[model samples]
Target: MSFVREDMNIVIVGHVDHGKSTIIGRLLADTNSLPEGKLEQVKERCRRNSKPFEYAFLLDALKDEQEQGITIDAARCFFKTDRRDYIIIDAPGHIEFLKNMVTGASRAEVALLVIDANEGIQENSRRHGYLLSMLGIKNVVVLINKMDLVDYSEEVFNKIVKEYTEFLNKIDVEPNQYIPVSGFFGENIVASSEKTPWYSGSSVLEVLDGFDKEKLPDDKPFRMPVQAVYKFTGDGDNRRIVAGTIETGRIKVGDEVVFYPSGKRNKINSIELFNAEIPESAGAGSAIGFTFDEQIYVKRGEVVTIAGQPKPKVGNRIKVNLFWLGRQSMVKGKEYLLKVGTAKVPVRIEEITKVIDASNLQNAVKESIDRHDVAECILIAQKPIAYDLAQDIAQTSRFVIVDNYEIAGGGIILKDLEDDSAWLRDKVILRNNKWENSNISREERAEKYGQKQALICITGQKDVGKKSIAKELERKLFNDGRIVYFLGISNVLYGVDADIKHTDNDSREEHLRRLSEVSNILVDSGAIPIVTAVELSKGDVEIIETAVDSDRIIKVWVGEEVTTDIEYDLHIPNYDSLEAAVSKVKTLLQDRGIIFKPF
Candidate 1:
């Protein structure tokens, strides 16, 4: 049996009033893609409203859009060429609907950026070009519209092309070709027009057909994020299924599979799919599930890969290129929900290295990324997530940020950042793999103690009452019948670091590592271990953070002013008395759901 190839998603984007909708309407009408009476119905409405007929009216199907003469959202229209089918996405050109345009264009394989030659390159003209480049749409066809308005002048078309070409160059984007056309008049749209005698190139329809189809990444290593584990025991089914779409490569029955971040291994027992006979194998793009031979634990955020193949980078920190579309500014210290593939995690912007004004491609020294601003920054996830660099694995690297439960921004992973304690983390991973497990699990210990485990680090300048508050807080929890302990920083220096010298930075890090290792054990024993260290910077705390899950650490700084980059969970800006400080810390613990309510 023969199957039609996958449809190519093409998006048309530009500034408001640049005639993006008109071009799409014209393409659909010219190609005979529109259903019967659809065109006449739109024209009849225009006639009844005492308005001149326009091709754009066909796509501005919404009543508000027709009244306002503006598209407020992205609309998908279907068309076909003899070679293959096409899904033409009509993305709004207004700046207010920039996010809507991104939502459409982000998934497109090719882009047709329309610029009104009469208006020249507007604000969104440059902005959209920069966005297409950022969205990884490498194949672009620049169409300079409204040539008829300029009397089809070659000089006018050439001027717009030169200016727009320079702008695209600033963003490192090279267009496939520059076509001068008039969507309203249907000049050089489906066929060559005599009005443009100086121009000689393939029509828009021809160029579109010439574009190559997107090839599936079968050669890349298999990557399937475990979305869910299914067990239909009540339905009389004994199979435990791992289900998700294969993003790249293939997996077959009996193949050795590894789930990342937790690093569990198993073999694919059988390929399972509804309404089909049992298949032995499946390739990329197959939305299927499988049963594993072993009862290994794999979570939703983990990626499944062939055991011996290339594995995705696993970490909590990443350098990203993002476009902010939130009404409020994307600021540091604010927690945002980041979703990449099937993995969702709470993330914070660690640092904004640079911000670029998309309108002019100029760099700005801004403290916060405002709406419509593009930026490069480092993002720290609450926990480690498995992913790949956008260049290496496009399917797994793109992500979205949800603010206020709405998609506020989108980004691509430029590179994976190594945590400060990467070397020590390697050792921790190896240690956990070889560590013995008892019948009592970690969750059981947490529930038995009636409190969550945490490495509560209290640090500040000398004589700022850091240790006093930590000790009092520990005493409070202990009196409340909760598992708690307080240890001083100097308590382990003489014993744990007897062989290492004070001047060696590596030895100092090792000392911190040992302290964290001990904290990890105490946490496993279901104790809230509070450790007091003097002036512990973010980098210093990172050592302890890697050995234990950072989520299990409660950071509190006791000082009038913070001296380090560490964003502590709780801060005592005014340490007037020990009792007040202890009360505040205890209240914070209660708020974090780490400590149960006291009687």
Candidate 2:
């Protein structure tokens, strides 16, 4: 049988001065992947700096890095062995450059962790190893680099291997291979060394070549986050094609797909790769476009998945395990934008359950996650998003939190609690109860108003004439001698709750928390509140209703029905007619015993 080695991406990760760059340089040099004159430039630069030309100089291409003898960013290089072609991503080893490390590792299939044979496992060495595991890079090769410094002794290598292996095993990172090599002296890289007779093992290149690439898991549920929509017009016919890369799993022609959080469904008519209309199937790592049978609703950042597979939950609240990288400590109630794949959303840290100390992997009693700390917490987004558990699907599960333009933290979703209605309602109610009684008693407030039977919540998509309806309804209710609290969701989300900013999706959890808290205050104060949100999922509506302790919540479905249930689902025939929607809300309120006329 003829076998062809597929393309593989490998990243080299370790602490600074642990020879990550040297190992990559040596690999490129030994494999003859270096272009002619590249090494001469590095040598000439090193000479100008009045420093010896080290192998690491080859990858420190930046002028500042070459001057300081430190790597500030990740460098990518391509090399091929007789067995396979590989793209080596040399990730930064400094703790300050962890974001860069995550950037590089996000695109890699395997990681090579280089640890100093003499220094053993340092802070960043272990830190990068833990992050690699968290990022779902299962294939690892632990290179005990710089064996020459320890006299190439088998006893030293064995001891270091035993200690590091035990540590990694505790963190659930059992490397595929552990090799002793000296990247500086070219020992056990391409050829085995005779210095350590008892260390009988294949060279790094041999181990890499012998690695079972087929063992990597490629069988996941079909998930392709739509990146862009292509329209080839003016040719002959108008064509609209949705294009994106398959993050995981396989999609075949005629397979049913659902676009979310829109919940639009369509069938795959054809799969289109570059210059090819492949008939059969498309798998992970395939960047292709698809022509659907019908022009269903699809947009960028929406996850396209195989029907009947576990659908992504659309909600405001999510449980995540995060690693904070900002210089300032991550505090609760602060807003940020959460970026997952191509989706950028406003999010917030609702609560910090515990911070995991990376030094010992123990839960520490910390108020907030400081720089370079990992923590497990609950994150909530402002709008509903499609996501899976990190354990179930790695692609859609992981996300990055961006504050003001820079990435501050990265995390993986541990659970999706959209279906847990009881839990969701309880959280809202508890938070409301805490915020209550600060001003006045609910009964006293109810007595202050005359004849409003119950608090009603009017919710729908933003700019879907929600504010207009609210104003009209308030006018009708006022004419009927009833006090109406026209509390706009946007007003509360922006004005009274000014602490919560709608800058980006990173502060989503904080936004929801504040929004729900304010809405609860309004409802509990015995006023009819009209709230509007562009994308309120069924889960969010349920939570809001339960929080205010009222079944009077009415949902007007302006667009596609993303939610499951609504007391009054009004899909307007002509949204242009504001008078019709106002008339409907008045009748619905009257039917629920909310008398319009005091007489």
Best by TM-score: 1
TM-score of each: 0.75, 0.70
Lowest lDDT block of 10, candidate 2: 429-438
lDDT of 2: 0.74
Query: Which candidate ranks first by lDDT, i.e. highest?
Result: 1
Cα lDDT tens digits, model 1, 177-227, are 999999999999988899999998988988999998878778899999988
lDDT of each: 0.85, 0.74
lDDT of 1: 0.85
Evaluate candidate 1 by giving its C-alpha RMSD to the native, one decimal. Answer: 6.0
RMSD (Cα, Å) for all candidates, in order, is 6.0, 14.3
Clashing pairs counted in every model: 0, 21
